[model samples]
Target: MATTTISTTNIIQMTVNDNDYNSHFEGNLLDISADPEAYYRVVLFGYITPIFFLITLAANILIVLVLSRPTMRSPTNLVLLSMAVADLLTLIFPVPWYFYMYTLGYYKFLLYPALSCNLYHVMSEILPTFFHTASIWCTLLLACQRYVYICHPTLAKVWCTNQRVTRTILAIFLLASVHQLLRIMPTIMDDNSIIMNTNNESMINNEPQKACRQVIAKWTTSIENLYFGTYFVFRIVFVHIGPCFLLVIFNVLLYNALKRAEKTRNKLLNKQQSTEQRNGSSGWNKQQQQQQQSDDHQQQRKANRGRDANSTTVMLIVVVTVFLIVEIPLAVATAIHVTENMFTVDIVSDRFLSMTIIFSNFFIIISYPLNFAIYCGMSRAFRETFQQMFLKNLFTIRLTARSSSLNPFISTATTTSTTTNTTTTTTTLSSSNTATATTLTRMKNISSASSKGHY
Candidate 1:
């Protein structure tokens, strides 16, 4: 390998370096030496991936916490919660292993039966991919539901009931789980070969050896490649490109419909207001004015809801795009490796490129905790609920646990002490009304002070 310095702008260029052609085994060497810049790129990714994972975990936990409250449940929120759960998984699982090995120096976390490695591999890879795909797909469903409700109000009134939405969400979860589960099989057992653990040490010339190596040969590689390639193509076609295009189209339609609805509502409200002003004190004018105000209120609410939906849709799109952009290269690279003699240098570059993707896994883990932040950013109601729960924790909690000293005798003793002190210091100037006023003021101050103390 030859060494060179690279700028931030050329990092992606480095990944797609098209200069050399070599076989997978011969083509590229993993080197921080060849391109010191590549090392920095990997290191930079290492730093960001963990941070993103933490953010994601915190955010998703917050979402779950907020939604778990009984009062917080709603049809839309239920869907949001599901998406958050999926996003949380995306951010939580795989990155921890990377972080553990790279940062914490704790590899060999999977020390179970060698079979467990295959299981862990399947689970570690499949679950996150499935959940993320579900999250993206769910966003599209939610957007479509909102669109129906907003644009075709009459049809929505009939078809978009809470029950229907719940069923749809359940279906999505089940389907996504199944779809993603299909990909998991490749990691477990490729073709007719099971990834078995064997302590079988070969004896060379009747001499036993302690050292043994796990073998995955060319036949297995070909089989694994076929499985990965099929899923890779499926994911690119259905999960990545399909959902992205659908979301883009859905959001565009949603935006137009919302705008048109706002215009119509404003027009009606204005017309009604003009009718009221011209009619001048008739019963009809009063009725029209009231109706216009009501219309304005409803329009404001619709506009707010539209804005929330749009924001959520956009954030979901960001999550999906980020996942795809980071992950696709690895799949493509691996798939290309299947065809032994294709572009050799590109394959080596792909192998090196695959490292960047592997390092990027932490970003997704960090995103798991972040699903709540996305919701908070996108939805006013969610933010309001979050604030009410955490920001106003004192007010939100209902407890009457006053201090032990706040009893009747304690209050009387304090009052008596104050009165005695006042008697010694003052010239008998207090009337009954004044005394009553003074006591009430003292009590008010004490209550206010107590409330402050409680908080």
Candidate 2:
């Protein structure tokens, strides 16, 4: 979630009262401000939001691991891998910062003054925005790649190469970094100087005075106006709105292409079945039969690849859809807040805006972890690969160990039974060997006849 930094100059001008800062720091979006309801809401969010972040962190980690596997690597999966990495970074710094900020309150500055203030502004705000921007663009790239692959197959071969995808992802990260730097440049952290309390001369003379401080983070007014007035509008249009619009267009094209592909596959399947029935009655020769079987096998493999690709495309569409559902409201709210100056308005408007931002943030965080579930639910290859990576090998090891432990008992039982029926076993083995040899000779003669027929 993006946040506008509020000036703290007024807060700094206020006299030190009760040895504490009088106002919230800059970039502090959730202003509870003694409101019982807002405070409780924040407390609730502080406690519950971490759980969501943890889940998102874990899920994105799994996504990275699975997509990084050699067997799973593809242009599409590589793009997804980049997204998972971005999501992972999105939560890594912010979760702890959020926990400290909300649960412990803004007094963190008093304890670790400069560290807390700088980290709060940078980690909790800027870093997440940077990575999230990358993630959004990555989703857009996935949609575009799928659209081209499904709608224009010939072009997909040239455009969707793994190297090109990697370069595109890098370019996205670079652009996001540059954008973040522009947003960060206007905002600066104030020197949090520790001050000694000297209210009482007697206390000052007797012992070391107690220390108090306030950390300020604010933007230069000129630069701030320039950014919020112009570049911010550009950001909303291109970064948030443009990608979403293009994703919708691509998704529609992909869905139509999917329908067409399905129709074509059905037609081909029916044709193949009719041809097989005709050949069955006509008695095809060995060479012709072998050639037909080879062609069918190749066709089946091609069809399976196509099906897997289509399934992945559908899964990506759902991911992009969910992203839009969660993001559009936030984008609209942000645009309103920016245009109407919602934060600087009346108390009721400010409170409503804060709540809107918080809830929108909640939904956005929830959306990050959902891609894992979508991949598991929709893509057969993803499920199979996940099972192979996490489930199958573990089970195979246990089963193998269990079978090994029972092997001695089974071997002993077999030896005793063999000892009791030694003569009968020998006679049976001899007859079996003779039958196998006769069968092998008959198969050899048939193979020779088939080879001669081919020649």
Candidate 3:
């Protein structure tokens, strides 16, 4: 067996006997000889990416529709809307198109080398990276919104408005664009190349004194040495690892606050129950009944906060988890690739890492789209709104009557009665909006109390 390793110039080199020869290719078009596994690659990707496309497409569309409804348009919902858009960009453009191009490249359906280069560079690399980065930052923004809502409720009303959410989303994309542009520029932008020698002295002699003048974006030795060496590690840490830690920590703090609130509410409830038991059934008059109702409402509100925390945490954990699973392998693979290219190690000489990365990339494609499932499953509020958005008119009355039935834990009993003219949804969310705000306010105090205790 031959030893194959990525060379110092960032090109793969296979050691061969003197009688054997290394073929030299100048273009980015998939060479049938070098890539014997292209057929299986096509078949695997054909089945996988389309599944991603359909699921992601349907899920994000549902999310958009659900969030676009009147009562569902909260500040947190706006952040979610932004996330759906960012994910949709990837599904709409980069993902499906890659399928088309990959199929074409494998089967030689369209042999236009120039076009293939453009497709690979722009569609496969740059555009997807752009939206993927946007999707990541949108998640960070959601975490930030949650932080404000749970930890600083007084500021959430002021800071977590529609205009601010829009501006923040825009700023995120803008920064992501500039940052990713710099990262990907080494791939797309023109650069001088030091093309590798293939052990064919005559072919090397005949090779152009200047590297191939035209390109579908390509990374050259100069670009790698200039940009990638300095930025690759930093990019992975800053954009990938750091944000993952931030998200986990934010959710942890939010979860702790909810636990504290639940503890306090439980103690109060137990104390009230014991007092009522001592007072006995004969003492349960109209005034006592009213006070008990107040106590029940308090219990319901506490339960609501806990339910809200669980649902939100479930979605966040799943999304962040999928992201970590999808992205971490690719990041590690790329890091190993860069290290091998720089130092010429043969630690992973086979195609396993590349295949792992390709499959992992599919999940990343599907991650942004799966949030709809998370929302629908973990949240009664989301399911209710989703039904009203899509399954309206036909099932509105039946479903609306049964909306809070899915999870009584999430149902807000503190509703302010509305005129008969108002719709059920209007009354439900109106009260829900109040309850949510109040719960967050209590959580704010809980956070403050914890802070004071620690201090």
lDDT of 2 by residue, 297-350 (tens): 999999999898888888988988998998887777677677676255543375
| Residue 380 alpha-carbon offset, candidate 3, angstroms | 1.7
Candidate 3 structure, TM-score to reference: 0.67
lDDT of 3 by residue, 1-455 (tens): 11222122222223332322222312232222234455555765655677778888888888888888878878778888888888888767665555664644533322234445445557766777788788888887787787787678899899999889989998988987887677655443222233333432312543422221122233454354656666666666767666767777876776786677668768877987887787676677788889877977887797777668657755765666666667777777766776777677877864876776667776676566668878888777789887766678667677876876786754444333443436775666577867787887799999999999998
Per-candidate local distance difference test: 0.57, 0.73, 0.65
True-vs-predicted CA distance for residue 34, candidate 2, Å: 5.6
In the predicted model 3, the residue pairs found to clash are none
User: In angstroms, what RMSD does candidate 3 have relative to the true structure?
Assistant: 16.4
Which segments of candidate 2 are over 4 A away from where they belong?
A: 1-37, 40-44, 105-112, 191-224, 277-291, 342-348, 400-455
lDDT of 2: 0.73
Q: Which parts of model 1 have CA positions greater than 4 angstroms off?
A: 1-47, 106-116, 186-228, 281-371, 395-455
- Weakest 10 consecutive residues of candidate 2 by summed lDDT: 1-10
Per-model TM-score versus the true fold: 0.60, 0.73, 0.67
| Candidate number of the best TM-score | 2
